[model samples]
Structures are given as C-alpha cells and as structure tokens.
Target: MLRGRARREQAAHAGGTPPADDPLDAAQERRVRAVLALGGVPQADLPDGVQQVRLRLLERAAKGEEAPRDVSAWSAVVASRLALDWHRAKRRQERLGERLAALRQPEHQPSGEDNRLLSLAVARGLDGLPDNQRQVLVLRFYADLPVRSIAEELGVPEGTVKSRLHTAVRALRARLHEDEVV
Candidate 1:
C-alpha cells in the first residue's frame, strides 16, 4: 500500500497527467502542490489539495464557462484558499471535540464527594507542573494517545515524551500523597 502511494506521489511530482479528464495539466498540478505546501498544508495532504483544485476547474469547464485566462495562476490561488479553509476546518473540529468531551460523562461514577476531592487534587497537581510536562501528561492520558503519536504531534522525540510523562506522574503522585488526597 505504501509503495503504491509512493509511486503515485512520484508520478505527481514528475509532472505526469494520469487521466484525460483531469482539468489541470502536469505543470498546473505541480504549481498547486507548491502553493498548498507554502501555504502550510502538510506534505501528506498535498495530493488531496491538488485534486480539489482540479475538481473545481473541471466543474467550471462543465458549466460551459471559458477556462480561466491563466489556469496555472488560477489553480495556485485556489490551492492557497484551500489551505486556509483546511486550517479553519481543523480548528473548528478541535473546538467541537473539546466541547463534546466536556459534555461527556464517565461510565463509572464514584461517590460524588470523593470524586470531587480527587479531581481537585489532580487538577491542582497538573497546574503545578511545567507546561511541557503537563502537555505530555494530558495528551498521553486524557487524549489517550500513544507516546509515539504524541511525539509526532508535538514534534518531539519519543524519549522526551516518556521522560516528561514519568516526571509529571511522579510529581503529581508525590503531591497527592503529601496532601493525603489520594
């Protein structure tokens, strides 16, 4: 599967048009990819962004409209706009996820008083940790992300994530014990 993907990417960058129906030519596709990349779209998503630009161009052609006077420039502008839209959608999705998570209830409900006290202690302990350590802990535990995924998302090494998790957990545990809250 990966090999096939690699081949497709190579074909894309090689300036080869795959289908007769594709509205954007090879050079146009390359320009679209460059625009999207410089616009902050990740490399993995470039192909999809280029295809989106092509789709819009094709739709315009289907509508019996004259092709844009300069298709290359037009595609680049479209790709840039797509990149901005992508970031907006990503932010919106993240905000919605947070709101949904806040509304979610845990399957097992402990005694309310005990649960409240423990939650307070944990929140306090989390607040006392350094920002990096706290981020690692939350991503690992609350987000339920594996260490490797956290490292990739944060652009840090796995070892760094592991070390931060260990230090944060130890500090929080010590604080809870000291306060007799856990």
Candidate 2:
C-alpha cells in the first residue's frame, strides 16, 4: 500500500495528467484498494464513496482551487477532522447501546472504595469557610461557572467574586495539604 502511494505521489509530482485508465492518482488508487481489501468494509460499503470524495478534494487541490502549495497539510487537517467526527458518532452510538443494555439488565449497585475523600475534604474546608467563600468555590468548581457568571448570579461585583475565589482556593489548598499529612 505504501509503495503504491509513493508511486502515485511520484506520478503526481511528474505533472502528467492522471491516466485515463485509472481515474485516481496512484496513491489514491492504492488507498481505495486497501480499504476495499479490509474485511471491515463490504464491497458495497462507503469506502468507495470516501475515496471519491478524497479524489475530488485532490482534484480541487491540483486545480489550485485550494492551497495547492500546502496540500499535504490541508489534507491532514481534513482527514483528522473526519476521523474525529467518526469517533464522536461511534461514541454516541455506544452510549445508546449501553443505555439499551442497562434497560434489559437488573439494577446493579456500585461497589468500590469510597473515592469521595477529596469531596469530603473539600466539603469540610467549605463548611469551615464563610458563606461567600463557599459560594465562590461551589460556583467556580462544582458548577463549572465562570467568575463573571458567578458574580452576576450572586449579584455581586466581579472583583468581589475574584477575591472570594482566591480566598477559597487558598483555604482549600491548606486543607488538602493537611489532609495529605494526616
């Protein structure tokens, strides 16, 4: 596959028109062949469609419609984005499958070490804090809210929010260090 791709690249660099017999450049043709040969794809699968899209992209590239001088870089970015989309779709499908499987199975309780030590420590530190300090920490970390948002939510000034967050963080750090020692 690599050799075929190399040959195609060489042909492309040679500046000859793509052969009438082979619609794709040598590398693209090899990629199509490799994808078809993979058992994962049925003969009628979208590998051919993907190849066609890639070829079109390449053709556009060759015609200088796209950044031809940085074709490889652009192609890499396109391929990476495509792969990321595929993975995200796959993950969504897997989550749906897991939900269906859970519906069919008996309810299962979680059984593991109570990993809430950090939570407990933080809670203890928070309990010892003034209400404003606790609110700042809860908004910033627990709710994942931004400082400006927290300030708006609490109807306070942004500087006040920053000050509270700073104090909360310092207190938490000291508490966490003491917890580690004990």
Candidate 3:
C-alpha cells in the first residue's frame, strides 16, 4: 500500500497534475480564470500561441516545478504583456477602420456664408501683414501652436518665437481696432 501510494504521488508530480489532496488546485484555476479575463482573452478568442504559453506556465505550477514565491509575479507579468499587445492590436484595427471609412466617404466641401466670411477675413488679414509676420501669426494662432513648438517647427529660437508672437498680437489688435472704427 505504501509503494502504491508513492507511485501515484510520483506520477501526479511528473504529469503536472495536482495531488489528490492539494489545496492549491482550486485557487490556481480561479487565478488563471481571473488573469485571462483581465487580459481580455476570452476562451473562444485565445490564440493558439498564447494558450500554449499559458498552459506551459500552469503545468509548471501544477507540478510544483516553479517557485511558489515567483508564480504570482510571473503570472502578472504575462497578463500585463498580453493586455498591452491586445490594446496595441485593437488600436491598429481602429485606425485601419477609420482610414477605410474616410476612403468610402465623399470629400467635404465648404459651402456656407460663414465659411466664406471666415476665409475672406483670413485672406485679408494675411495679405495685410509682411511675410514673416504672417507666417508667425499663422503658426502661432491659426495652427494653435505653443511658442516652443512654433520655434521648433520654424527652426528658430524661443526668443524669436516670443518676439514674433508679441509683434503679431500687436498688429492683429491694431488691425481689428482700425476695422472696428471704420
């Protein structure tokens, strides 16, 4: 009886099965389910490669081949990496879908009085300014860029950005003030 029991114990450990009385079996199953759910890997959608990796990890745990202290840490790392990969793949699919939708839609054309008025105002303002001032104002306000970003985009220094912004603001304020008076 002692020999038979020993053989069974050895077999269980070698085959990666929990012993008949192992308390961790139920806890391990629950942990695996939670990890899979949190990683967004539904049983039906689990890829073969991922499933294989998870199974190998679980088998090692079941056989008491992996350290008890490291199991949770390893499991968490795997779950986090899987979740990150899923999110990246989902984002790519969303971007592709958006591109396809844009391709299917007709190009937008401005046709309203408001659009025309805005265009005319912009054109008149741009025409009135010197080229450098116009470029600065367009980069600063029209593009809604910060001074640092504008400087970087224009390959100029931050001081130049500040000066350009100050000059443009004064010019626009003067132009608007004159238009109001007229």
Candidate 4:
C-alpha cells in the first residue's frame, strides 16, 4: 500500500493525473505516508488516515480559515500530531483500565472513597517513575508479559527488565505508604 501511494505521488509529480477517486492529492498522500513512516501508525491505516487528513483540512477550511501556504508541511504536522494524540489516548485508556482493576480489589472495595484514592495514587506513582522503570512495570503488570518477553520486546536483558520492575514496584509502594491515603 505504501509503495502504491509512493508510486502515485511520483506519477503526480511526473505530470500524470492522480487517481480521480482518491480524496488526498499527491502532496497530501506524501505527507500522510511520511507521518506513517515515522513509526507510530500501522501501515494498514494509510488509506483511511490519508482521507481523514483531507477531511480534516476540509473541515478547517469550512471554518473560513485560509488554506495553508505550505500544504505539505502543514499536512505532515497535522498527521503526525494526530498519530501522537491517538497513541496517548490509547495509553490513557489502558491506564484507566488498570486503575479500575486496582479499585475493584477486595481490600479496596469496602470503601468507594478508598478505592478512588488508591486509584489516583497508583496513577501518580506510575507517572512519577522514570521512563525506563515505568515502561518495564507497565509491560510486566499492565501488559501481563513475563520478564523474558518484556526483555525481548524492549531489546534489553532480562535482568535489566526485572531490575526496573522491582525498582518501580518499590517506588510505588513507598509512594503509597507516604500518601497514607490509599
């Protein structure tokens, strides 16, 4: 699909008419492909994402904003930002699920107030950890992956993965104990 899009872009640049049915022009297609190649978005989403970029531009134009003077640059930025937003939203959803699960624990269930506090504390602890430790913890606990799997996924040694998880868990425990609210 990427190859086809690239071909179409090149063809457009070479004076061939773009696909009449395609929503995105050659430049927009190029920008969308560039954003996808940056690695967050899956290749399968190219067609829909390209169309969505065009639709987004159309929507902005409908708001009476002038067309961007540099369409390619603008499209690339918008597409990249949108992919980042999607990635963050997915992480937030996963974190919310983890917190909800923690809140549902038998010990925390007796008081809605306590559950809420514990959930918030966990979120804060997760956010406070260093990126390496937090990522290892998330892969270990949230993703339910074993140490070996996490090490493979993260391209690190299993010992490193375990070390990070242990440290992250310890830090979270300390934070919870400090709060005395959860």
Q: Find the candidate with the highest TM-score and give its number.
A: 1
lDDT of 3: 0.65
Cα-based lDDT at residue 154, candidate 1: 97
**TM-score, model 4 to reference:** 0.44
User: Mind giving the per-residue lDDT tens digits that candidate 2 earns over 72-108?
Assistant: 4444444444445455656666766776577446565
Per-candidate TM-scores read 0.49, 0.37, 0.34, 0.44
lDDT rank, highest first? 1, 4, 3, 2
What does candidate 1 score in Cα RMSD to the true structure? 16.3
Query: Cα-based RMSD of the predictions, in order?
Result: 16.3, 16.6, 16.9, 13.6
- lDDT, candidate 4, equals 0.78
lDDT tens digits, residue span 56-159, model 1:
99889889998999999999999999999888867766876886576455576557897789889999999999999999999877666679989999999999
For each candidate, the alpha-carbon lDDT, in order, equals 0.87, 0.63, 0.65, 0.78
Give the poorly placed runs of model 2, Cα more than 4 Å off. 1-114
The parts of candidate 1 lying over 4 Å away from their true place are 1-15, 105-182
Tens-place lDDT digits, model 3, residues 1-182: 98999899879855766567543453553464566567777676543324544576768768878554755556556655776666766776676677656644656644576456655665676788887778888876545457898788889999987887788777766775665521
Give the runs in model 4 whose Cα sits over 4 Å from its true position: 1-108
**Candidate 4 residue pairs in clash (backbone atoms < 3 Å):** none
